[model samples]
Target: MNTNAEGHLARQQRVGTLIDLFAATVEEHGARPAVSDESVTLTYAELWAKTEQVASGLRAFGVGQGDRVAIHLERGVDLLVAVLAVVRTGSAYVAIDVGYPEQRRVHMVHSARATVVVTDTAAQDSPWDEKLVTTTVGDLTEATADATPVVAPVAAADPASILFTSGTTGRPKGVELTHGGLVNFATNAALPRILPTDRMGQVSSVSFDAFHYELWCAIAAGAEVVVMPSVPELLGRDPRRELKRRGITTMLMPSMAVNHLAKEDRDAFAALRVLCTGGDVILPQACREILDGQFSGEFYNLYGPTEGTTACTAHRVTADLDAAQPVPIGVPLDGCRVHLLDADLQPVPAGGTGQIFIGGAGVARGYLDEPAETAARFVDIPCGSSWGRLYATGDLGRLRPDGLLEFLGRSDQQGKIRGYRVEPFELERTLRNCPLVEDAAVLVHGEGDGKQLAAFVELAEDGAPAAVRAYLSERLPDFLVPATLIKIEQIPATANGKRDNEALREILRDDLHRRERYQKPDSRTERYLADLFEELLGVEQVGTHDDFFALGGHSLLAFRMHRRITRDFGSGLQLQDVIRHSRLADLANALDADPTGRPIRA
Candidate 1:
């Protein structure tokens, strides 16, 4: 056989589909622990048995090939079982995060045409449609079937899952991922090697693409999957204690989390054998700190979008890497291709910047039920000897002299906030539809972790900023909601009728000056917090009552502050405390009220 043919045959024999690879892993590692959360741990054999039972239950309920099952359970062993069960029944799973707004969940289910939703028992009374089959994880686990359900033949190209991403139309688009794409990614050699003895922490939300990285990649290599605690628990808890307690050897954390650990506990990742992070820009200083510390693990900076699987490229951060510039995105994975092309779809000249396009086995099938969008993004391009499809990432990047890919910002209005894709048009449309708003425009402000969504609203006569914010909070996810909502007489427009973002920024500057008045810190607690706020927000002379959000503080920054408070103040303040009591004075008061009367750090 030729080289390509042999590789194809080898892949088919080993992992024709994700299910096949998983089954093989189960057979080899049956006695070993496969996955565990705080509630339960399951060996590979036990996990397979549970998955079989759920698959049988699904088959009995008339779910079969081509069906899409919505999995809305929280992060746990049950969630993993439901996903495997759905795939085993020859159906695709649609992930619906439990924390999503009710309206958003409804839209996702309706858009994906999911007739069945599997949720936790506690969520049985949720507002799912009466006509849909709404079953709980408990029901599936306890279900009895007369005979074992036969496994359906799964094709490599068949859809494995549909992930919802922010869309310009104000509704999320379901990006269909194929079984082949996932299998290719899980087994690809270009990724950081996951050892069988490694215990990888599953931190990403089920709806997030990184969940695949945390679960599939670990399980495929016969590694133990350790699901971390919820967002609240993680933020308040010390990083060094938790990772050590869990015996976590590998973790794919977000860049924000990595940076926080680097700042607070440089040796937090000492127990980890492989530490990989991505989703946002990796700060050079943060990487340097970790590398310089007691962390003896392999550290990598990953980069990719949902359209190109979880991660397309990874750059290992060594002690010798240049600390002057942002780390390169590195080269494509074994089964993937990265192309930097100009407007005409031709490759950019050497060392020139162009839009990044991803092509290969990991490229998604495209948006479900949206042919126009699929055609627009997933286009046929000339490969070496044949025509192949490539997803136009809309992200700008350039090839370095060493052939490594360096990332630039987006080529379009879309931006990434806390690793989630943010479409300004989507936020603007939601704002315009608000009952309190007459007109609205949304723009991204600041850079990196300080980046936040700012909405300029020309409100109706009876509308108020507070009421408008509440309206948006009710409709959109916390990440999607604007951090700053400014009342404007009208949204500025250019002479050519385009939204004049420059003019809007000038108005924002004037508004900031009008609202903010410097008041020096009075107490020791207040002064300490003021210093942190100034350092985090990249501003000086912070007023005691100045709003954190108005000063460009975002969720990531808030998380970092939460960690710092717990460590420095010896308080039990939760992540919500930092956000709810955003003012410097308010936060100081909360910290003072903490029952733990340990003195603040020097």
Candidate 2:
């Protein structure tokens, strides 16, 4: 083993500390390919030269130390070059995930108050960039008047990048990472295991902090980074064939990878060497699947947040997890420390659950420009002898008897249901264990006075909503039972692969409205009204007009009503027909006029 203390000491250095590594790669692997995607391949020397040119171009635009630059581009060579260029100019790059909604994109840009926004011509049309200084990839790559490279002085503590994280409480917060912090993290967590002989798969978007590890880990170690293009099919398609095609030896992501493995031919990924995953709790079943699958690779679980660089705790998944209750996050990376503390920041007893606190070079500079928020998260290390502070991960976990870290759910996600603290993840875990459910998400709805649990689930080949409801009723307590159960083809996810709770909440809100739209009927008119409500609302039960929105019925639902009436009942209902006839009884007259014998109008 190479015994060098340089990697450990480098964590305290400033952001520009890795400039030498980039320069050295160009000289040593000048002709060797560095980044390869379907459209282009760039050698280390070529990439270095282009990065220098882009940096020079950026400097001409006055980007310098402490300046924040934004890159709103797709996953491509140009995007990589832009990131490197900003770093080379001694400014941190704020990656804007192209998939971000206009509002979130604007929030990130304005929050950063970026000096310049680097994007392509296609992105300039987006309304979000209207007020920012925009630069195109075409302009940066185009030949310009001769300009000298501008070098800015950088310290290890200086901010190198700002990663925006979508927190559950509010809008996204920017996590500031120093150059030394990232370099140290990459060295300790990635370099020791990866080598130049490895062909690594880069799957996460550049906007995510995980991509930072993917890109730099390869470049710093002289390994080849295979850039996978972002395609709709690739997002939901099997990656096994692609992984094998590129000879991809390593990849890292959350448990979602299990979904991909389930769909692909098992033999396709037989060549994979190392598979690292994290972001959320990995199910025990998923762990068993990987072990029994085609890839004979070492699997590692990395745990941390954008605020703690890439990751602080790691657990190498061995065969033991196949029989364990929950896998531990393992020991801390070199130069880092992990602590499980109670509400008072006091160390908790071994085997007792507590908040996980991380301290070391991995901890970031906190949310950018949000002083109060920064102070709240970056608390002083009360139990450690560290020179710096510790970051309260907001994640609830505990230390195992073996000193390994076992992650519980988020502290904030813990909510009271019927006077008992209920963790949504716990319910979700139970739902998933039924073997009939493919995936499940539980959300606590309502406020202050009346809170209830709602569950949305996607079933396996052998399950249905009714069966799942019955199964949960038998396995869980009455308080833990969901008020509403929805069955979807698949659960939508945020760009980072986490369950989109907001979206699910909207679905539940709609379901509630649908339930109240139509009441039971005592007469033929009322029965017809209930049938109309069911057909119009696309739900089995409806009680009243006040509940239309809760049933997932929107303005588009109005259009369906208009079409149904026009076709079956002779009434030529317009778009406004549904709005005026919000109640089932009010709409029943229109259906009566257009009776079943009438020919449907266009």
Most accurate candidate by TM-score: 1
Off by over 4 Å in 1: 1-9, 383-385, 566-576, 592-602
What range of 10 consecutive residues in model 2 has the weakest lDDT sum? 229-238
Per-residue lDDT tens digits for candidate 2, residues 461-480, read 88887788777766554446
- List ranges where model 2 is wrong by over 4 Å: 1-7, 10-16, 128-131, 143-145, 189-192, 230-232, 259-268, 384-387, 414-602
lDDT of 1: 0.84
By summed lDDT, which 10 consecutive residues of candidate 1 come out lowest? 1-10
TM per prediction? 0.95, 0.69
205-286 per-residue lDDT for model 1 (tens digits): 7888988888889878999999897543565566778989999999888887777668777898888999999888888889
Residue 281's C-alpha lDDT in candidate 2? 61
